[model samples]
Target: MLYKLNLEHILFLDIETVPESETFEQLDDVKQELWEHKTQYQRKDEFTAEEFYERAGIWAEFGKIICISVGYFTSKGDVRNFRVTTFHGAEAKLLKEFKNLLNSHFSKPNHLLCAHNGKEFDFPYIARRMVIHGINLPYKLDLFGKKPWEVPHLDTMELWKFGDYKHYTSLKLMANVLGIPSPKEDIDGSMVRDVYYNNGDLDRIIKYCELDVITTAQVFLRLRNEELLSDNEIVRI
Candidate 1:
C-alpha cells in the first residue's frame, strides 16, 4: 500500500542544526541560568552545564536550523530520478526559503512531508524554529486540531517501530539493517555542531544534509518494499 502512494507528491527532507550561540558563555545570563536548570536532570553531576551545552542542538529553544535539505522523486516511464536541494545560511533566511517552497509547490491536500523520525524531531523542530523566527507555519507542518489521520507528515522511523515504542533505532542503523547505504558515512550528526561553529564549513554540512534526505527517501522505498534508487537516479540540485 505504501508503495502505491504517489512518489512525486512526497517531499523528503532532513535538517542540520547547531547551538544558537558559538559557546555557552555567549548566552545571556538569564538564558545561561535556564540552560543550567533545563539540563539539570539529564546532566546531573556527570558534567557541568557549560560542558553539556554542546548538545543544545537537540533542543529547538537552544538551537537554530542551519540547513534544511529536501528531495523528491519523479519518474518518466521506467526511469526514476531524485532532485535534492538545500536552504542554508541565516536561520531566518533558511526558514523563509523553505516556507516559501512549501507554500508555493507543496501546499496541497495530497502532498506529504516525509523524514526519518521527523514527527518527533525534524517536523516539530522545523515548525518550532519557524515560530521562533516569526515565519508562517507551512500547512503541512501545522497540526492545529487536525486528527492524526489527517496529518500529512510521514515518519520512516515511526513506520519501522510498528507500535514498539521502547526500542529506539537510528537512521544509520535502520539503513544498515535494510541493506541501504548509510548517508552519514563521511560526517555524522555528532560532528555537525563543531563543523558549523568551529570550522565554518557550510558546504560540507549542506552536502551531508542533502545525503540524509536522499537516504531517507531510499529508506522509505525500502520500507514499502520498492526498488532502491541507483546512483544515476540521484541528481543534486
Candidate 2:
C-alpha cells in the first residue's frame, strides 16, 4: 500500500551502537548486576553476562549509540536528491547535536523520522540514551501521551510486517527484496564493535552507517513505488 505521507517531509536514519565498555569486566559492580539481570532471559545458563556483553549494544541501558546517519530528500528544479550526514563520536555529544538539528529543522508536525525496525530499536534506544544524557527529547522523538497514529515516526520493517507481530526482516533482506542495491560488505553489525574499539575506525563505521541510511531511503521509495535515486543523486552533506 502506498503511504499517504509526503516524501519531502520524511527524514530517514539509521544508527550503530556498541557496548558501553570495551568489555563486560569494565562495568561497575552495580551495572554488572544490572546487565546480568537484564540479559538473563536471553542468555540463561548458556552464557554469562560477560560472555554476552558483545551484544549489549542491542540494549540502550547497556549500549551506546556511536553513529547516527540521516538522509532527507531535497529537490532542485526537476531533480530530487537524498542528502546525508552523520553525527558521531562521544554518544552524548553527538546526540545533543542531533537533537539540536531536530529542534531547528525537523520538529515541525509535518516532519517524520523513518528507520528500519525503528519503533522497536532505533527510536526507543535514542530516547532512552537522551534521557541518560540529560538531553530533552525533540518533539518528533517524544511520544508521551501521543496517540498511536499521532507519533511522527515511520518504521519500514513494521510496515512490511502487515500486523504480523512475530515477523522480523533485516534491512539487507528488505533491500534485496525491493531490488535496491545492498550496502554491505567489509563488515556487518556483529563486527562493528571490533571495528570501532579495536580498529579505531569511526570513519569506516560512519561509511557503513551512511549506506544504511541510503538503503532505508531507497526502501521507503520502493514502498511508494517510486524510482530509486541514481548514485549521482545521493549527496553526502
Please give the CA lDDT of all the candidate structures. 0.91, 0.91
TM-scores of the models, in the order given: 0.97, 0.97
lDDT of 1 by residue, 1-237 (tens): 586689999999999988999899999999999999999999999999999999999999999999999999888998899999999988999899999999999999989999999988999999999999888898988899999899998888989999998767888889899999765457889999999988998899999888888889989999988899989999988
Superposed by TM-score, candidate 2 places the C-alpha of residue 104 at a distance from the truth, in angstroms, of: 1.0
Per-residue error at 63 for model 1, in Å?
A: 0.3
Estimate candidate 1's alpha-carbon lDDT, on a 0 to 1 scale.
0.91
Candidate 1 lDDT score at position 237: 85
Q: Candidate 1: misplaced stretches above 4 Å? A: none
Q: Which runs of model 2 end up more than 4 angstroms from their true locations?
A: 1-3
TM-score of 2: 0.97
